[model samples]
Target: MQEYPNYQDIVLVGGGHTHAIVLQMWAMNPLPGARLTLVSPQVQTAYSGMLPGLVAGHYRLDETHIDLVRLCRAAGARFVQACAHHIDPLKRRVSLLGRPDLEYDILSLDVGATPARDLPGSELAIPIKPIGHFHRYWLQLQKRVQKTRAPMKLGVVGGGAGGCELAMAMAHALEEQVYSGRVQIHLIHAGDKVPEGYPLLARRLVARELEKLGVSLHRHWPVAAITEQGVRSASGATLALDQVLLCTNACAPPWLAAAGLALDTQGFVLVDEQLRAQGCDNVFAAGDVASFAAHPLPKAGVYAVRQGPVLFHNLRAALTGSAPKSFRPQKHFLSLLSCGDKRAVAVRNGVAAVGGALWRWKNHIDRGFMRRFSELPIAMDETPAKRPREIVAARGGVSLSAMRCNGCGAKVGAEVLHRALEKLPAQQSAYLLRGAGDDAAVMELPQGKLLVQSSDQLRAPVGDPWLFGRLAALHALSDLFAMHARPVTAQALVTLPLATAEITQRDLQQLLAGAVYELNRHQCALSGGHTAEGAEMQLGLTVNGLADPDQLLEKSGARAGDCLILSKPLGIGTILAAEGMGEAQGRWLQKAVEAMLQSNAAAADLFAQHGARALTDITGFGLLGHLLEMLDGGEQLGAALIAEQLPLIPGAAQCVERGWLSSLQPQNAAAYAYVDNPQEWQKLPQWELLADPQTCGGLLAAVPAEYAENCLQALRQAGCTQAAIIGVVTGAERPLAPVHLLRKADWRELIAREAETVQS
Candidate 1:
């Protein structure tokens, strides 16, 4: 009888070719009860095969790139856009650049090797291993070539296949652009031959290709250092060149060797025939980043690609408590290399060089491989309804959708939270008129100045501590700014997760650094607060701000006909939710994080300068919910919102389409039911997206109709480009129309009126 595969998680740590194959295979024939995840720094993975062709101006960037976002979506794998810092074999976790530890039952490492060998000033020199960086550098070089009409001297380090190809490609490119045979290209190598490890015939073909491209080759010469002049060899010989490209022997990222995993002499992970890292049953590694201890082979893409299936099967075997299948790597594999200008060189066993037709054949293979990722679209197969027994069992636990508690219970669910906030009553003082409850509570001044106090807490559901800290500081300061008060002092509340003493200290230092950086930027003096131990990390701030009685903008001053303006785009909550599930794109998520970190200090300053009547920052409560609160407190004013004019972050509509909403979305949407056309309003994507909750979000204010444009202009100059007039205030009626929803036509008219008024 076959053993049933138990539920397990198989995490692929990189978006290399091997992992791409793994994702495709997993999508086609998924292993029962196995959860798959792919983690990388970017959503797009460039096909190395088409990279040379791209540089030669044959293929467009998108044409030569595999969309990891689309591929992972198709595979039903969690795709996290983050850089891996290290692995903790003992803890069965992989640490990330800007997020929490990702635990794995079975981990596969297919992260390709980087060019990090011992070359002096290597940090200053560019490494060709990170193709993303190389692409940017190459573009810069092309612009330089176009701008500088003088003869150019370029140097290529390493006589390896990659180095040779880039040298010829650069030379060919420069020749096309400059029309000057004055461009000189030099290839420097520590080895005696161009393809030192390959058969001599293969070397001759590559040598011929290099000569054809007019690349001068220097063999048996090692570079000791790279300088502005050029590469300096160990024998004290320096090759002069204007630009240097380093494509030396590929070495594993040094951070990997220190990750508590068994490593070979060259610092690659030591794996058995089964691709399992030595002495670590749950851990596995592959590609150029891994070395077979028993039968070590050269770092090559073919081996990495071959290991994917074996790795997949072994992972399933490990999950189901069965014996793992071994991967016996072949003694030799076909090597198809690209020469500059759409030509190629193929080497098989003892046989050697072939071009033209062979290059076409290689091109077919490369395009075919890329099509697996690019051509296929993700179609999520409907999950079969859970059986009665499983459904019953799932209902017994605390619901993931349970109503959140306030104060301490207001914290995120324990399972999801990095750390819990400690609940403590504010310290009592005679001078303290109010503590942490109200938005900018009143406080007795030390002298003639009046003080306002407010506080806020944030539980990070996703992303890193530094990012969380930045958002936390901004969130805390929003209360002061919303009250038209200048921030003066702040005290931090920190709750750290379970970790080693040293790690805890480092986390605290980093978290504080992030917070201090934001606080200092706004000139808020750092005061003392509290810290404690918890299962998850959290941050909060208790802040004091100063305001004169006459200039203060409370939440209660809106008059009838005041224009309602929102000083930032909506959908942060949707983005945050997507980020938690690893469903967000890297660039979009980066923008959201940047927006969250931005201080409303500047916007508030402009609001005070421009004579705002009333203000409130949009936070956990949706925009509609916050607007309702302002309506209740303001001067018997009702609101009529122009749904069409609302600003939103990109991808927010898709998030809503996919049912990715903030946990608080339901409550916020319910709050909008008071409006007559709430359902009709919900039909509009922007209005529907407005129900998304935000953390450290933008401000909403009631300004005079005449001054609204000036206020918006002030906001733009103050760095609030997303700011817009969203609605207008109205006199409260007997039926109590506190909020009115405008139809699409009316919304368009409101926006036009605002634009025309601004232009006039």
Candidate 2:
């Protein structure tokens, strides 16, 4: 492992082919004092070279896509799963759609292009760029064609290699499903012939292949508009089609034009031969999004791949103040086009050849390129190169020759922490008598009000210190919300890894800033706590709130006939655990983080308005454990949890099925003994998720049966999109069982019984 102090930040805007290559290279030979950050909208980026094969059912989704999340982890880079909204070149910051603006000393953009959608009724057609979205739509189309026996008409726009290849691929896929005779396929192009830019032989071969596949070729035709019935060409010629796919001229993202960067006529960022953004020394651009001003090249994946090594070299040069080498693209390159079968056509310069052997060669090349990123070199354990003794002494007084401690030995020095604390802003409150300096913080209580307290701590699940702190504070505050109390103050308990005094102080500031930001959002004052060094990062918050005696909610007030409402989705525990092992996608973890950061204050108020009888925040003990606490050996009151109705995070069920669970899951599963009628529900993959411990989870409340729907609606309107009425409380007739697991088949019966009980 490599470590650097006070490193410079390098932010990569997208996980394109070039950037993906750069990340892998950096992992092998990392810059000594540079930190890398990758910002991408999707966790998996598709390889364009293999996309035609994927459409033809020759490849699986996972086989053609690179997992950016796992790749970043292997590269020791921070992965921000968010869309890049804009760039501030003057300020050196990249603004994301739903997160904070990322500050960078160096910035790079490798976001690929999308099809031109400015034509009339273009939104009605599917664009092939932004490959992730296209792949999902393609899957749905495949399922639709397979299920229905009705005839379908499909049109492909554009005469280039992509458009031609896709038309043939779609035909091949439909034929495989035995719908070839019923489905009509059209390849529409503005040019006079298919494969317009290819050699004469390649063009003739592609034309012959299209004819063999029974695909109609509409030459010298440009689409004027797309309607529900069909496509209307510029010459008043109309073609009836059920669906249209546009593989027309690729265009730069709209955000690039809005960012005020120097762009070419087509709106792509202009870059020099060295791949540096024109007129911006600290910025670089590559892939389909960049236009090489000196020697222009076609917007192809091959050019992007060729530019990777140069971009990587130049980026390092910019960071270390070295001269960058120029990049010169070859005048001509070989192009291999898959014929939607086991054969391919290879064209280079003015020569062309066709054979199954060519297809195999292309397959080997594409797979080998993908393997560079997918199968990264295993990291080896090697001793650090010896540094001067004086340099080691200046850093922390530890000898460079000595091995670092594993546990408490990795903690920071007490004197170092004390010095860091002096630089922090003073946090004083009317409720706090003595500030954070003493052994403990002292606080005063308001007259005639009850004190509500809750404490929570956890090891950092994310690499960002600020994000971890914010999550920690939110986790603690969730308890106050469940109790229907107003948060007044909080004390932080932070543990940081051993590092230099400068690095320690910097991390401390970021951690506290995040915690304070969340605390101040609720008008809660920070009353200081304790900080110490540790083997790993951990953050804990002890929150104090004020509650009115008459309005306070408790776990003991749950009634037999109440409706059980969960304010958020479950399965976050499984998601986090999967992420730790690099088995989770970036998008799933992103959703989990957003859920954890949401404050439960509004949910609490809504629960109270809906006449909730009992409330508790789900935490480390899992939903079953917390619900069991409410049951508490009551003989006359029991609960029924509907398995299908439970709200779950997007990929949680899949993770559970894969046996990815939190370390504390076994302890929480012990409460299964309290369940009376498990039935076949216990065999479900989601069954284990009930015992999965959550961090900063949602509130579980019991409300009147009649108001359940209304409460759920209000919660959804208030942005708790996953909120659902999972089950209902039942009157216990059998004393031996207090909990019941209801499957989908038992839903109607349970509802009928509840209705009769209410009527009685």
TM-score for each predicted model, relative to the true structure: 0.67, 0.80
Total clashes, candidate 1?
A: 5
Check candidate 2 and list the clashing pairs: none
**Model 1 per-residue lDDT tens digits across residues 24-96:** 7766666544557788887677777677777777677777776676667666666666799888887777888
Which residue pairs in candidate 1 have backbone atoms (N, alpha carbon, C) closer than 3 angstroms, thus clashing? 405-410, 418-536, 418-537, 419-536, 419-537
CA deviation > 4 Å runs, candidate 1:
1-11, 30-37, 97-100, 350-357, 375-586, 589-593, 596-611, 614-697, 700-760
What value does the lDDT take at residue 387 in candidate 2?
35
Report the Cα lDDT for residue 433, model 1: 64
Error of 1 at 746 (Å): 23
